[model samples]
Target: MPVGRTRPAAAVFLANLVVASGLAHPAATASPYLLALAVLAYLLGLRADRAGPALVLFGACAALDLALCAVLGVGAVHWFYALSLIPAALLLPWLAGRYRQARLALVHEGWERARSLEERQRSVAEQARLRERTRIASDMHDSLGHELSLIALRAGALELSPTLTGQDRADLAVLRAAVSDAVGHLRDTIGVLREDTEGEEPTAPAVEPVEELVARTRESGVTVHLRREGPARALPPLVDRGAYRVVQESLTNAIKHAPGSTVDVGIVRRADRTEIRVTNSAPPSGSPPAGPPPAAGRAPGHRGLTGLRERVLLIGGTLHAAPREGGFEVLATLPDQVNPERVRSTGEPREESGSPASRRLAVARSGARRRFVAAFAAPVGFGLVALVSCAYLAHQLTGCVLRPADFAAARVGQDRAEVARLLPEQQFRYVPDAVRALPVPAGTVCAYYRSNGNLLDRVDVYRLCYAGSRLAAKDVLPG
Candidate 1:
């Protein structure tokens, strides 16, 4: 037997010993031989095949009976009759084993199902977390980056005003320099926010015209030259955005690291693909690069080539950034079919895709809607159904288990005097004491009773208040 079965078998053996001893002392008058038979039967019940052991026990008991009673052939007939118990004992282990196996199977199945459900819930939660992070990062890039860029642009223009006095010029230059630094800091922050650690779908900016994008780069003090060879065709949103960002970042880097260098920005469109190239000479000695100035709030390498490479690859594009003839060069090629509708709908200057802020907002909204729907719908529906089913089952169970007599007694008044008069002999002492112990008012009677039995049995009674021959109130005794 298994270790877990030992305790139950031992308990059954002890209980059977006590029962056999009690039966032997009573009408059975079983002898030592009969006691031996009983012990064998008890042991057999704990093992696999009880029928054989039970038959042996019956034969032993019959022989003892015959030997004591001095009867002829009577013991054999009695033993045959006693053998019927063998089949009943044989069924005990089978029934118990089946029941135990079924219960264990049910428990195992429930545990497996619960584990599966938990895993599914965890997967969904993880997806939701990723979506929320993406949305937040996109929002930060779009809103903050745009505002800082505008500040830097305005400051640059103010410094260029020719009518300013010496002090005014110096102050304007300082302010412009500060603003440029702040813009660089903002770019770094946006770059960090836009990092897609989860490998989520890329949230590229909407496509804009190549010329207009070049104009924006020029405003930021980066010299740009656009060269195109073929009929212009609308590229996919991802392709356009990827191409735009590659050129944008490349020019930004050129301005920041190679001041006074004439950067060549070129866009080539063919029948099936588009290519972009940007190259600028290294900055002049002792002159700060024209890119956004360093600032405390910006991330390191904000305008580095790494962000540009990521943008290019996100849209199925290829990028190459390296030193060429004492200057840096970035080359990229993008496919022509990414997503045309998303590109056209934004309607920003065909060349001037707004800041990353706008692109991030659109992606965040899309992801949030999808995440919210998936998060709550299925589990909440299952829980509501389970709750309703449980309530219905509880109602049915209550109806099935409640006793009709008790229910009726609650609705009707009880007669305490009748209850006391019908009390059984065994219950007479306790029933009267119980009734007298009740703090009932004078002329009112109270008694205790059972819910069901003959009148002699303790039928349920109640505290009865009668006023002028009419029943005033009744309170039934609690079970």
Candidate 2:
């Protein structure tokens, strides 16, 4: 396995070895070589994705150390001092490493979240741009298609007039057919832009009145009756365009669906609103459809009424189209003044606050923040416990060491009672193996003490032996 992948296992193995060796010889825990190895093991554990076997191994070692020490009849203070090494050497470094790993993960997740959000925003902007382009194309198609129909109607009328020569009539027929072909091409271009999909189209502005539109249809051999009830007044551009479109579209539908029908158009301009109503009577019996059939490549389904409804609603108006008295009827009410600001505001696209992607990202960020807090809190808490324990162990261990001056003051043949006051309250439990193996005089009981109280530094040990209630010999042992 790669080094990075094997780090956790190495940490567990090395940490267990260090801890086990320290328990066998308590003084080894203080050696720089062993302490450095323990620190390295903890640093390796930081790479583990979860808490690994190191902690369990440490607990097992601690229990075994205490049990072995108990069987050997070691002092309670020595056992407690030995137990404190577990947290200071193993648990503290591991906790700190885990915290460092968590901090790095939090930062990485933040950058990823920002990148994902930016991508989603870019996608949304692209979609909105496409939709706007499609709407503009639809609007152009509606406006131009209506005007072309009017031109074709005029050409047909000229072709029927008796005053025209035979050559003139043939030219007029050609002109009308060309106009029909132009309309078909326009439809095909819009269909290609929209991929055969229908979209809401807005009406183009026109200064023509409903009366002029009706008169033009009448001249084209269609029976159209126009009635204007309200006083003549200059209307807003949107309302004027809407009124013209309502009559034009209704007439086109009557001509195509019910030929030879009598169409009635009523325009009533009130103080607050303009009302337009167009109704066509049922077709005469045996009357064929008036307009030419749809051309090749033209998409099916009529989109005129749908476009009209969208345009009317855009200007804060209402439009209704339904069948009445065996014919079609269209009723529209347009307000005199529409709020341009409101219309523009509605047209502009906005980011949706409740979108699923947005919600999911928010939740992920929240979770990352919580984990970061927890990672920091756990290490700090573990560190505090370790510090308190280490401090207590240090205090107890300091009491067990004999100062160099005290060792120097003792005499080899001094009375035991006088020398007793120079001795410390406890004996050093971490005596070196060399000192323990030294030859002792016959019938002498030997006790070991560290030369100094400093916990981290390697120092000499003093061995004092007593024989027959008198100090027989005292010597310094290297550590």
Candidate 3:
């Protein structure tokens, strides 16, 4: 399967399982109602609807609490405390999903833009190649064709002259024959150049077996020696191609620049890697002569070497070429397990390595992996943070909601007792004065009786309440 689809499906499944388990055991209620809440929370968390899922989750939690607890309305009242969590659980995931989708869309759009740019570049390259071919054809026609035409015209004029003898006419005929041969050779050279410019046929299948390659080279009037250091096994195609190109280019170089020189080719195969080396001796005179170097950006037009490099690189191999011990040498090594047929079918020679399609596929796979990592990381991180925050808020709500009611009941009982002990005549002045003088800690709300023992107004003097070591709600009057 493509990488993009596999990871997200796994993440959704795992998240559902965790959310369900968390909701089921809220405060030791083992009732099936609570279990049903867990299942509902899992479903809601996984789906796309934000408000609906959150409402359903909240309702399920409240209903389960109501059914199990003996207190009539305590569960329903407590449900209000859970309202704060709805936004975090539902809205956060939806927003994150939207953000992720946007990010993926942006990446795909960028890739498409890049592909368009590459197509433009390829078009420009093809135009440049065509222009170069035209220039070469024009130069060949002007130089070789013009020279042959002039030679033919002068020879014809000489043969027709009145003073010319039979022997002179025969010499002119031989000269014409030589000029014709020159024109034919020039045409053949031009044809080869044209074939190269268009996408011409491949040279030939690479000769296998070092002996066979050496024998083939010998037939073309060049002397070649083949050497092997280890027992030979059938090599991978990439290895074979690299070795063949090294030998072929080395032999061509020898014939062009060091005519009549002997070539030495070596093949060595080890358990881990195979190596090929080709060397040709220096020119006969033993001293390097100076001449104009090959044209700018042209390396003897050796397509074989270029293709060999592509083949090696496709299979994670390496190649090297340089002067070695008074001769030029090319060397290459390839790993053992590479499929030779696949390398040949894919390794086309161009001005660069690999086709555009292969590179695009590689880039796509890399992008998908990055997206997958990001997809899981965001939600898992957010879910953990939400869960921690939810537990903390629930704890705070328990204290905020239940503790105040307990304190109120305690304070009412104490106030009733204080009123019962007060005397009617003395209570008016003394009772109010005593109540006013009583100390209360922070967060204490108190009701005090007047001297006459009737109900007095409530005081939200929580700041006046205190315990000895810890601050807590305190009554202004004793029970």
**Candidate No. with top TM-score:** 2
Model 3 reaches what TM-score against the true structure?
0.36
Residue pairs in candidate 1 whose N, alpha carbon or C atoms collide under 3 angstroms: 142-356, 142-357, 185-298, 208-350, 209-350, 209-351, 255-291, 256-291, 449-459
49-129 per-residue lDDT for model 2 (tens digits): 666466676576567667766765554445654566544556666666666666666567567767776776787577557
Q: Candidate 3: where is the Cα deviation over 4 Å?
A: 1-208, 285-315, 324-326, 339-479
Which stretches of model 2 miss by more than 4 angstroms?
Answer: 1-5, 26-46, 51-85, 88-133, 157-171, 195-281, 284-289, 295-326, 329-367, 383-479
Q: Which of the predicted structures, 1 or 3, would earn the higher lDDT when compared with the native? A: 1
Q: In lDDT terms, which candidate is top?
A: 2
**What is candidate 1's lDDT per residue for 1-479, written digit by digit as tens?**
13225543434334334333433231243334434333333344434333354445445544443343343323322333233332223233324433343444445555655565566567757665765565465445434444444455455556667787778867866776775676566666656655453333444556567678678767766556777777887766667666766765665565545656788877888778888888888666765323444567754335445555555565556788778998888889887865443323221223213544334444445544543453345346545765785575445333223233443444223444443233333221133334445666567533333334333333444344544444445555642
Superior by lDDT: candidate 2 or candidate 3: 2
CA shift at 412, candidate 3, in angstroms?
16
Where does candidate 2 clash, by residue pair? none
220 in model 1: Cα distance from truth in Å?
5.7
C-alpha lDDT score of every prediction, in listed order: 0.51, 0.69, 0.49
- TM-score of each prediction: 0.42, 0.55, 0.36
Per-residue lDDT over 310-407 for candidate 3, one digit per residue giving the tens place of the 0 to 100 score: 54565657878777667677787777776444443212333332656446545555655654564567567767876896675445333222123333
